[model samples]
Structure formats: C-alpha cells, structure tokens
Target: MLTRIVRMAFQPEKVADFLAIFRDSEDKIRNMPGCRHLELWQDADQPTVYCTHSRWDSAADLDNYRRSALFGQVWPATKALFAAPPLAFSVYPAGVESSLSSLPASQ
Candidate 1:
C-alpha cells in the first residue's frame, strides 16, 4: 500500500474556507478508485497548519487521482489558501520490509 501525507500551512483567515472545501470534497476523494483510506489532521501547536493522510492501493492509483478533475478543482482552491508551500510525500508502513530500500538515504 502507498501512504501519502500532505502538510499545509494556511492563511489565518482562510482556514475556514479550506475546511469547507475539504468538507465538500472529502467523500468524493475517499470514494475514488484505489483509495483505501483518507483523513484530515490539524496541528495542535499550529492552528493554521493541517495535513491529509491517505492510503492508496498503489502509486499509480495516487497518480491517477492527482491528474483527475477532482484534484484539478480541489488542489487549486486549497493551495490558494496556503500561507506557505505545502509539504507532501508518500511512503509504505515501516513494518513493510520491502519498502526499506526505497527510503531516501540518510543525510
């Protein structure tokens, strides 16, 4: 499985707007093909910061979603509210031994 995480820092006044967009689109995104799980998270120490945790069947499934019309609509609106560029990455669970070699080399 492919797990994806995206951390975003939004403009203070735009937090509500971002939530609304997520609320409107969450179900559609979760129902997309190969979507195994989806969640939204807010930082405890940073009110303006939020993250999305999602699981997909494969990297290609995630990529397909990235290119979909739903993403086209949601991403632009979401990024417009960002106070900083978002941080996004994907990984496999640590328990998955095969994924170990795919991790980036330590600095």
Candidate 2:
C-alpha cells in the first residue's frame, strides 16, 4: 500500500469554497481505481489549514488519477483557493513487525 498525504493552506476567506468543492468531489475521488482509503483532516489550531490522507495500491495508481480529467478539473479549482503551495508526499509501511517487536510488553 502507498500512503499519500497533502497539506493545503487555504485563504481564510476561501475556506468555505474549498470545503464545498471537496464535498462535491470527494466521493468521485474516493471511488477512483486503486484508491483504498481517503480522509480529510483539519489542523487543530488553524481553521484555514487542511490535509488529505489517502491510500493507493501503488504510485502508478496515483499517477493515473492525477492525469485523469477529474484531476484536471479539481486541481485547478482547489489551487485557486490555496493561500500557499500545497505540500504532498507518499510513503509505504516501514516494517511494522520490526516496530512492534521493539515495543515493551506490560500487564
């Protein structure tokens, strides 16, 4: 599984618009091929800041979505609402067994 994270800082005045766009398009995005999960999160102290967390089967899956017409439409609308450039990255599970083994057992 490939996890993708995107941080967006929207213009304060455009937050509602951004949310509306997200509401209208989230279902389509979540239903895309190879999309395993999707979630939106808001920063605790910043009302204008939001992030999208998603899981894809692979980077190529993500790339396919990015090149789709859905992205072409959504991204331009989303970009117009941003106060700053978005930050995005992808990561894979980092050996869960090794991390679990390092944990101490307690009663």
TM-score of 1: 0.89
Over 30-59, each residue of candidate 1 has an lDDT whose tens digit, in order, gives: 999999999999999998999999999999
Q: Candidate 1, overall lDDT? A: 0.97
Poorly placed runs, candidate 1 (over 4 Å): 96-107
* Alpha-carbon shift of residue 59 in model 1 (angstroms): 0.3
RMSD, candidate 2, Å: 5.2
lDDT of each: 0.97, 0.95
* Model 2 lDDT, residue 107, Cα: 75
Worst 10 residues of 1 by lDDT: 93-102
Candidate 2 lands at a TM-score of 0.88
Best TM-score among the predictions, by candidate number: 1
Candidate whose lDDT is highest: 1
Give one digit per residue, the lDDT tens place, for model 2 in 17-47.
Answer: 9999999999999999999999999999998
